[model samples]
Structure formats: structure tokens, C-alpha cells
Target: MYRERAIRLAGAVRWESVSAGDEPVRVLPDGCLDLLWSSGRGLLVAGPDRTAHLSVSAPGERWVGLRLPPGVGPAVFGVPADELRDRRVPLADLWGPTAVAVADRVADGRDVAAVLEEVARGRLVAAGGPDPLGAYLAGRLAAGGPVGAVAAEVGLGARALHRRCLRLFGYGPKTLARILRMRRALALARAGTPLAEVSAAAGYADQAHLTRDVRDLAGVPPGVLLRA
Candidate 1:
């Protein structure tokens, strides 16, 4: 089973326990980064992805992860978001010996999710909190606001907005908007909405537009992803 919960920290926590017989998990792009710990892989960081990621695991493999909200990862992870884009790296590579200690604690049966949360909370505090403007921009884009309007609202020009997004979200505002729209469409479809309505409501030009975006970001058609 795969489950997720919104916690008091910066974002959501998810846990997945998979069996060898299960099909590969299709993870869609959500414009977020995850700090993940697996039974076999220890601790690793999953970067913001522009496309879907297929995850396969061994028999009885388990995973606990804390997903950081957009604009929060660079601050908490102490790295430029663009540097980690579309990549998964061992935490030790970024955090050094500190990451090793965290892995050891998880190996010793410490609550994996809780440990990740604690680490994130500490980093957030040290970083003097998340970027308020960046978070607001993320929210606006996710709500389907036009990038130009969002930039003007934030008192930043287009070029400045692009730079900020690259530093905070690992992509430009337009790409982030596309990712968010795709997520919105998927949520509506999964909730039993018709594809036509989903496409329109999620800001796509039409069903074909929705299909193309889904294929581009998720590596599959909407029907396949919805069925999965």
C-alpha cells in the first residue's frame, strides 16, 4: 500500500511498502523534492523532476519519505535546486557525515519519517524560514495564474522571475505551471471527473492538449495513468 499525510512540517509525508509481485510504481511530476529512506537504499534525495519516474523495488521493500514543498527544498537541503534537478543522489554526497549518521539511525529502527521531518525542520529554522515571495509565486502558478501576471504581482520582471524559479523550483515558471496543471488534471480525473471537464478545468486548451501534457510529463497517456 501507498499512503501519504500532510504533516506540520513544510510538506507531506509518504510511505510505501511494496512486494516483489507488484507492478512498478509510476510517480508523476509534482514540482516537489523528497528526502527518502528505503529498506535497501538507506537515505537519498529525490530532486524535482520534469518528467515521471518509475520506481521498482525488491520483495518486501519499504520506503518512508518526506516531500518538501516547492521553494522549500533549496533552503532545507542547502543546495541550489537546479543542481539536483531530475536526479537522485545519496544524502551523504550533500550532507556528508551527517547524512551517514542519519542513515545509521534509520537502520537502527528509528522512525524514518520522523527523522526526516526533524532534519527538515532544523534546516528550515537555520535557513531563516522559506522564501515568502517564492512560496507565493508557487501558489499562484499552481492556481493557474499566468506567469506574466504572477511576476508583475510579485514586483519582479520576467527575467528575474525565471532566475528565482530556477533557484527555488529547479525550473522556470512555465514548466512549473505545466507540472502543476498536470497534477490538477490527474486529481480531477481520479476523482471521477470526465476527461473533457478535467482538461478544461485544469486550464488545458482541450482534451488533446491535456493528453499531450500528460504524455510529456508522465511518459504515458492519461488513460493509462488514471487506470494505474
Candidate 2:
């Protein structure tokens, strides 16, 4: 079972899951960072993924996570997003003693989700909050704004924007734009929109284009994901 809800932290979500060990769960690229606690794996951080991550779980294992959106994670972790891309690392690797303290609390059987949220909130506050540019960049790309236009909108030239994107999003603007587009299409398709219409509404040239893009990043066709 899986469930999620918006939390007090801005643009962040709290989620919990009980993995049944049925099959590998396909984790799509969503330009986000997750602070994760798995009963089987202890505490870890899930970095921004450029492609799908197949997570195989042990039956009855429990997990709780706080997902911090895009640019916010770099702030919370005090590391560039690119440094952590497509990787899941033990929290102690980065947070060290701080993460160990949290692990002790988890061992004490506290509400792990709440604890994760508190950790994220504390780090975000100490870092003085997520970069304002992050929200703007993600919002614009999600809305289908062209990359050049977005860079210009933010008073940055092309190269500067690319550098910032790598540091903040783990990818350049073009890749981020593609991932955001496919995610929007996935959302629409999951909502029961017809595939053809989903492609059109998502600004794809056709359903075939959507299929190729989805397969490239998600490692499966849209039909498969919809079934999952």
C-alpha cells in the first residue's frame, strides 16, 4: 500500500508505503529528492533520477519518506544536485552525525515520516529556504515554456542557466523540460485521458512520440505504466 499527502513544508510531500514484494516497483523520474527510511534498509536519501529506478522490496517491509521538490534538496543537503543524481546514498554518508541521531530516533520507534519531515524542515530553514530560482524554473518548464525563454526570463544567459540547472536539478534545461513534459503526460494518462489526446495536450507531436519519450526515461511504455 502507498499513500502521500502535502505537508507543512512548501512543495514537499510526506509518503508512506508497505512494500508487498510482488514485483519491482518502477520509480519514474520526477526531478525530486526523497529522504527515505526503510525498515529493511535504514535511512537513506534518494537523489534526482535521470531515468527509472526499479525498486524491489521484501514483503511486509515498511517505508516512510519526505520528498523535497527539485531545487529544494540541494539546499537541504548542502550538496549540488548533480553530485547525487541517479543515486541512493546512506544518509550518514552526507549528514553523518546528524543522520545518525535521526536513525537513533527511528530505532526508538518514533513516527518516521514526521521525523523525516522535521529533519528536512530544519535543514531547509538553516539553509534559508530553497532558491527562489528553483521554483520559477520548475514551474516554467512544467508549464511548457521553452528553455531559452525561461533562461532569459530569469536574467541568465544560456551557459549560466545550464550551469545553474546542473547544480540545482541534476540536468540541463532541455533534459528537465523533457522530464517535466513526460511527467505531465503521465499524469494526464493516469487520469483516464485517451493516449492520443494525452499526447496532444502534453505538446507531443503524436502518440508515437509520447511513447518513445516515455520509454526512454521510464524504461517502459505508457500502457505498461498505466496498468501498473
- Name the top TM-score candidate: 2
Residue 143 C-alpha lDDT in model 1: 94
Off by over 4 Å in 1: 19-22
128-216 per-residue lDDT for model 1 (tens digits): 98888768988899899999999999899999999999999999999999999999899999999999999999999999999999999
For model 2, how does the per-residue alpha-carbon lDDT over 1-228 read when each residue is reduced to its tens digit? 999999999889999999989898999988898999999999989999999999989999998999998789999988999999999999999989998999999899788888899889999999999899999999999999999999999999999999999988989989999999999999999898999999999999999999999999999999998998
The global C-alpha lDDT for each of the candidates, from Candidate 1 onward, is: 0.87, 0.93
Tell me how candidate 1 scores on lDDT: 0.87
Model 2 residue 124 lDDT score: 91
Can you give the lDDT of residue 35 in candidate 1? 90
How many steric overlaps are in each model, in order?
0, 0
Could you tell me the TM-score of candidate 2?
0.98
TM-score of 1: 0.95
